[model samples]
Target chain A: MDYFLVSFFLIQYIRTSLQTAVNHPEWEKRLVFARYFSIAWIATFYIAEEPFWTNWVWDIFLVWLIVVIYRNEVFNSLRTTAQTVMPFVAISIIRDFVKGIFPKFYEENDSFFQVAVAFAFVLCFFVWFYARKQMKVLQKEREDRLREEQASRAQKESLEYLVNERTQELTMQKEELQRTIEELKSTQNQLIQSEKMASLGELTAGIAHEIQNPLNFVNNFSEVSAELCTELEEEIEKSELAEEDKDYIKQIIADLNQNQQKITHHGKRADSIVKGMLQHSRLSSGEKEPVEINALADEYMRLAYHGLRAKDKEFNAALVTDFDDTIGKVNVLPQDLGRVFLNLFTNAFYAVAEKKRKLAAEGFSSDYKPEVKISTKKFANKLYIRVTDNGTGMPEHVKAKIFQPFFTTKPTGQGTGLGLSMSYDIITNGHGGVLDVESIPGERTEFRITIPVSEPISQS
Target chain B: MKILVVDDEEDVKSLFEQKFRKEIRSGQFQFSFSFSGEEALTYLAAHPSEVVMILSDINMPGMSGIELLKTIRRDHPSAPPQVMMITAYGDSANHDQAMQLGADDFLTKPVNFVELKEKLLTIL
Candidate 1:
């Protein structure tokens, strides 16, 4: 490249030297500048320059220079071109009429200054081209960084949203669970209260029955005493004079005996009622023994009938019994099972008594008396005792709840409301038997208690 | 008729002892009592025909009144006392069993004198 540039500048100098006789002084000074400048410019002008002849000559020279030179630099075409073309122009004029590719002769015969300016112009072009490419690469990197930052921000926002939703759902579930717990607690409390009330009701019923017993005795004895007095007065009023009153004395004696028997009978019933209440309502200290069904049924039926009559003195319900002669004996606590029978009798009487009352109010007389029919039927393994009453029977609803605790169709205070509930407990729970009812409204109500007559109730 | 009142409660016996003392002294009727079912059985075994009617408590510590009645019915059905089971427990299971055991009648506790007199009249 330096040789080419020197040749180029020599041509230019020749053109100038041949320019119609320029002065010797101008030529000499111009020759000195052109000779070394061209060589120097050509030596360094390899990056942006294309060649006119044997293009690799300057590359060989550049290789030598690069091997020895320790210049740290970017590709600065303008500086390289000036460094290479400077010596070419200077050497061109000093060489003895050398012919080379400066081509100022054909390159519009431009002056040496114009050629140097063109080399500098090409250097500027390469620098600008590379600078634009570097700026484009930096822009692409910045765009990718923005996209990554945006994606991270989107992910963080979505995660926060999910956390918020899940927290709200958990809180709602906790509230529902707490509400269910509260409801369960309230239900348990209600059950406890119901049990306490049931026990209390049983206590009160016992007390009422006991108090009524003594009242019964007092009433009967007093009446008997009055009747005896009247009879004595009648005996005194009988005339026929005192001579042979011996036979008459026997008559008075018999009447006196009858009245005495009545007095004793009434007094004993009152005593027995008190005894029964004391026994049943107090501590359970009765002996468990094998008892005969016929006797037990008869006695409990009478006791239970009296209990019902004690409540309503005007009640006049007839009792009918059809005992099974085959059933033998059963082992049980007489007091407990006796109470169950008593309750059944009382309930039957209530049902019949109600019918009687209603019938009487509707103008029916004693022609159609209410009857409580108690019958026993023996089956394979158990004995069935049915107590039925001709009464205003239960409706479907009442029948369904009849065995539930404290359920009653009677007037509020007239019943402890535990009669059927406790009866169910005794017959079913205590005896391991079934207490069932069949009823038809305005017709009859029947309660059938099927119990194992041969089995020990204690095991039950 | 002579009456035998059998019960476990002292008050029941005492009430009768007091109420019937006058009539007993006058030779109108005989009235007696035994606390336990065993004693009642012992008394009845000796005085079988003496007892025209027996008022017995259904519940007792040993040998309940119903059991005594059963023995009476089995051993001496013809001369047996007309038993009336008196009790407080008004449950149907025992009442049904008692009546089924040959008990002539039943009486619940806290008794009414009027009803008792009528029932006695019917039995007599």
Candidate 2:
């Protein structure tokens, strides 16, 4: 009976140890060794006929092995083990106490005690099974939650990357569209300007023709009348008349002569203006010829100066020129280049004249001497022409648009606004040159033209 | 020398008459006036070989001086009268066209009477 009792206890210990090894695969080897040790201790107990204290020592050793196996969850595993074994342990102690108290009754009901022990073992097995099922459910829930979080984080990262990529593509497309729009706008402006120039040319030609005919009549008639007056004076001198009457007739003829002179002077002025208009209307032949740049520049400078003076008698500005003598002649379209120079000179004079007028209005004209300067230089296969003016210079905004067609600082009807724009085209497109302007507000303004000396001029 | 003056402006007749008064009085040159290119053509047809020179103004109504010169060159290739073109526009295009069409001379207005007189004397 004693061997059976020890064997039943050893079987229970081995089953629990194997259950722990199965539950924790990582602790399998240690748990298996513990099972063997428990079995060996039970064998020692039987072979040595050890006292009951030896059985207690083996039970403590088995509990210590369980504690070691569940080291990370020692208290939880201890409580679970206690819950599983407590009923069995309490039932065994009660049986031992009953047997001691009533030896004859315990012997008569030994079978009942065996049934109670088996019932306790079944209860402990159910408790252990329930606790393992609860642990499995908890572990499964935690793993599912972690997987879901990882999947959502990956999706969010992918979505963010897609958004950034789309934003970059949109920005690039917007920039391209803006560039195309700017190109279209510039092309449209160029077309409008060319059309305007064409119509203006025709108008100028018609007006010049009509005005030149009448101007010719005025000039010829005045000249003829002046000659007739001289002939009449000779006739009156030869005639026999009173000295006082002769003097009176002579004074009348003199006044008439002076009147004809004035008419002739104004008529010639009108003639020149008409010629200038015709020149403007004439189309360029697009022929490059060798021309003295200095002489051409000087002529246009005088023309621009006289043109301004004719409009405003009081308008005057000092004109200075520094020509590069070594640059004797350069190949260029003379008329087109002359037009560029005339435009630049006219703009310079206008700037200085405006400044002078403003200063005069402010009573500061006495100290201010309005000046326009033009200079030329030659350096290593390039020619430079600069026109500078001491005037009310332009601000940044105004200077930026000065070369745009129809952009002008002058009041309406005073400027056509095409002078500089056309000049810029002629120098750059026609002659393969560069035109640039620099200005400081309230100080000075300068326009510089750079052209390759030996560049073969294209017919633009 | 008989010179036919062709112009659109009617006032041109009086102006020319006055300007060449001395020459007209002295009979050194005889001047015939026509207000249009058609009238000049008619005059030339009526008095063929009588008119020695045509001082024609370009840019006239109905027929331009270039057309007139072309017509004269074609009609009287053997004995084409001297045709001088006068224009307000002294552009090289017209000048070159006139010269190419057998124009005797090209002059720009306002015409210098002194230079014209000298040129006429040289022609004479």
Candidate 3:
């Protein structure tokens, strides 16, 4: 009995220590230790008696109860109760039957059986506690994972919404910007066309005045030729011709030849003036080529001066030409620049001419003969040409808008103002150069054209 | 002096009439009218002495003024009538060509009659 009790206590101590290590209640181990200890004590009595009463043998039920009730690895309540009470009932029946054969060991109290039943309750509690602890830990982990998943999903949805909204805003802004650019371009083209018409109008008025001068000479010459032809014919018919008369007839012939030559010279000049006006009014294809700037300037300048002079024969201006010897040839579209220079020269002429017109109109005979100075020079990396005119100089307001399209002070249908604007486009926009103008009223109006020395990329 | 005006548009001829109103009334000038190159040639072949100069437009439908000027230069090498271009086509090519093709001068439309008259006087 002592040894059995000691063994039970040892098992109880180990189980209690292990349960404590698991951080669980140790009451189940204590209960199991007490039940097993009772079984061992009862068995010791049977052993000490040597053929102990069969009623004492009922103590063997303890081992069977432990094994059967613990089939689930936790004590089973129904099985433990069966092991304690049902076995006792069977022992009681056996004792009842054996009592008739041998009278002594038959009387058994039920309290021991009840005590075994109480152990079953403790075992059930231990089993429930163990299972509940394991389940609770697993449930907590599952809930935590679910919370993390929900949080991540919310972040993903909000981020996607933000991205979608930003894209929409960018698209709207792009559409608005495109619309504004289109509007600006349309207005710009409109202004350009208007300026073109204005300058064209001015040229037409100037051209009409230019062609009349030569025709007067033709009229006068023919009148003189008709009178001389009659005189020569009558003199030849006189039948008595003197040497002086023959000489006089020859003088008439010489006069006729001189008149014919006059008609020839002025007629060609008139034709060229009209041609220049037409060239200025025509549209350009704007193609580029390797061109001589100096010759180009001379040809157009002469034509422009003639065109202006042809309109008013007495509007004489001193033309000073300075050509840059080192200014190498550059490739350009002649038509484009021809019109540009024409505009600049003619505008210079107009400024001076306007002053001349006003002076004549105002009855000021003081000859403030106008002067136009044109010169080309080689600046670093560029060719700079300046056209300075002593004209009725522009006020600040007019100077500020010199290149603005369609803004001209001339009478309507007189100045299609596209000249300087077109020149601006050619020098700065097309060739990557600069066009600048400076003016002092009644003193000088100067236009500086800076073009790259090297040929423009498009021309090249 | 004789001045020959060549243009496809009859309006231009009448416009010239309006421009030279005084000259026509004076009967000091006798104007010959030829609508086509063949007609102008026939008039020229018969009355070459009366025609002092030809003022022709460039962009006619057929047998252009340049071609006519070339023919006149080729056929009448000596004392060929002065030919002046009077048209709207005044590009560099045309400018260079009219001078090259024996045209004494060139002008562009719409004709400034005052300039036209002076040019006529210079050659007539």
lDDT of each: 0.67, 0.82, 0.68
Q: Taking the tens digit of each residue's C-alpha lDDT, what string does model 3 give over A314-402?
A: 77888899998666467677788887788888888888889888888899948788888889987776888898899999899998987
Candidate 2 per-residue C-alpha lDDT over B3-72 given as tens digits, one digit per residue, 9 for 90 to 100: 9999988988888888888899999889999888888889999999998889999989899888888888
lDDT of 3 at A117: 40
Model 3 regions more than 4 Å off: A1-460, B32-50, B75-79
Candidate with the greatest DockQ versus the true structure: 2
- Model 2 spans with C-alpha error above 4 angstroms: A1-194, A288-292, A298-320, A324-332, A342-372, A378-384, A388-460, B73-80
Tens-digit lDDT track of model 2 for A7-59: 34434544464565567565556545655666777688778886555645644
Which one wins by TM-score: 1 or 2?
2
lDDT of 1 at A436: 93
Best by lDDT: 2
- The interface RMSD for candidate 1 is 4.2
Candidate 2 vs. true structure, TM-score? 0.57
lDDT of 1 by residue, A43-69 (tens): 545544644343344434433333222
TM-scores of chain A in all candidate models: 0.42, 0.46, 0.41
| TM-score (second chain) of model 1 | 0.87
Candidates, ranked, lDDT: 2, 3, 1
